[model samples]
Target: MQYRKFGKTGETVSALGFGCMRLPILNEKSENIDVKRAEEMLNYAYEHGVTYFDTAYVYHRPMHQGISKGFSENVLGNCFQGAKREKIFYATKLPTFVIQSPDEFEKTLHESLTSLKTDRIDFYLAHSLTKQTWDRMIQMGMLEFLQKAKESGKVRHLGFSFHDELPVFKEIVDSFDWEFAQIQYNYLDIRVQAGTEGLHYAASKNLGMVIMEPLRGGKLAVTPTEEVRNIWKKSQYDRSMAQRGLLFVWDDPAVSVVLSGMSTLDQVKENVRSADSAIAGTLSDFERSLYAEARKAYWNRTVVPCTGCEYCLPCPAGVNIPSNLNIVNELAMFGDVTLSKGNYEFQPPSERSENCVQCGVCLTKCPQHIQIPDHLQKLTEQMK
Candidate 1:
């Protein structure tokens, strides 16, 4: 229910925006979105003052399929039916990453509009901009396309969502006069791609910063290891782990809106309460130390500390090299070998760690010089 000024736009957005990536599903199947439940949750969030709803072109798939499938946006539109659309700002992305030509940009935009059943998008962003995509956008005259959209009143605010290295992030930020930008930020990813640095840099330009993956794709909010739980207890704050994690992000003044992809009413309520009490400068020195200790505990247990510099990419054997390492790290850190093993085994053979052919293609590219093939073999054995 708390609000913050969305950069210099003078629009006050709820600190906790509703992210529609993980709407309630039927029988735990992501593809079968429980539309009735989703509608109820959306209405509940709206009734409780969550005015910002974020969806994307690639959410709810298999059963629903496609970006404009209407499973997500349609449910939201139904919930807000007969209500003032202007009071609730709708945000979606143009999948420019998948565009092969300049004309495709307009096609994607019109598709998104039709999907959401809205003519004007309150906030529109270039989805998942890598360095390559940014350059391609320029080469294909994407700016001209955006200007045209703005002139037509289709997109009110222009921005981008990022997933590249810090240097490239700076390049993209400096490339255009963006109204806002979205980045993946959380306690565990402070130094990762477009971490706190990108957030601060964008804010420095007076551009509103929208945060995604605030829970690291729901990792931080789940149950923690004994060490992490002890650290949370020591913090002496009467809040759950999810609240603590959210408070950390919202406490930073640079953060304009912290998005949570909640699927259940309980999650919506918990996050809304966290947002209500999340004030900057509320964490004392001791509380901050507790958070640092918790982070160390998490790092010591779950992840291999890979910086994801993509030096270990392009595995010759088709192994999802970084993703496998991350899974191993999560299992080790959380002391949940069963969950980790299940996750690893459920993946397709091409993505499994055992698929590593020891080709050493990932090693030379690795900035950390990690023995990737060897470590992958070890992880595969351990999981087995």
Candidate 2:
């Protein structure tokens, strides 16, 4: 396993961290985990050299009937129960997004401890902080609570995971003496939330950066269009689609760890192999050009380049403008007609793109001034 020092902590963490969100499920019919299978995967990952495990409060809730629920944290606790806890760094978040008052911070922290079956967390984050939550944290004395937890040995490191604009992200980064921070990053999302700018900003402050959705929620690995596949073939270096995507982030020294939510033993092995061979500065000029070309092709074919900034928000008719654009973009970029259609159709009729009342509220707010209502109508027509 390749190791990198975590910020200024003098602790070396694996370059490829194991995300516990998408562990293998045993049964097709229940939310209860197939413990035996999960154990095998976890043990395999540990043996192969992954040392970082990330989970959250709502990780295993039954989002759908066929999905396994309420087993991630407990299963992890059981899996690493008797081992030297220091050998592995376990990171989880305090669900501050759900808090209504100051007391709830302590309540959530204690609950996370109980659930993980650990005395002290190696890294703890103020989960999914937005502008609103950041304000609340100050009003509720969250920083004091974090300091107390650190002093009492309940948390080894304190930080946050972000999902808002760059300005807010920078504010949170500069707000505290943080050990590290997490952000959503990928090749296609460089200009989106936190983006490349945010990554460099965190590194400049000497904060360890953890990456989530490195694969864009598994979109990067699935079947590719002819144009994307052709671009990959042009590369002189041989690598899997997943490896190429991972290397893009790993190539940047600013990124500390790239998290992949692998569910199978094969995935674990493949990722480990990729990590072993993926050195900094591994991608040559030609390879970088190929990737850039492919990305350009993808953008040209499918997306409007909307960054989900919600600048065009507050649609008077309650239409989710950005989401509608994304569905259209995915359909055009990936050519996954079925997926695009299914996601659109599953939306409640009131929430569908067709529900737009064309009141122009979103148009006025749009930074891009996109004709959102017209785009939504066009998207619905194409998708249907």
Where does the lowest 10-residue lDDT sum fall in candidate 2?
Answer: 61-70
- Over 1-384, each residue of candidate 2 has an lDDT whose tens digit, in order, gives 787777855577888988888877654422456778778877877888888888876576564433222557787888887674557888898777677788877877787788788999898988899898889888989999999999999999988999888999999998889989999998888888899999999988899989998887667877779989988988777777788888888888887888888877888888988888656677788888887888888888864767677887666787878888888888888887776786686465666798887787887888876778788888877865
Angstrom error at residue 183, model 1:
1.1
> lDDT (CA) for every model shown?
0.81, 0.81
Query: For model 1, how does the per-residue alpha-carbon lDDT over 1-384 read when each residue is reduced to its tens digit?
Result: 788888865678988999998898886565678988788788778888887889876567443233333356666666665555667998888787668787788888887787777888888888899988888888999888887898899988888899988899999889887889999998888987898888999899999889998987777877888778878877666788788889889888998888999979899988887888767677788988887788777776644667666667677788888788878777776676766775676466678888887888887888777778877988888887
**C-alpha RMSD in Å of predicted model 1 compared with the true structure:** 2.8
TM-score of 2: 0.88
Model 2 segments more than 4 A misplaced:
26-31, 64-70, 303-318, 338-384
Clashes of 1: 5
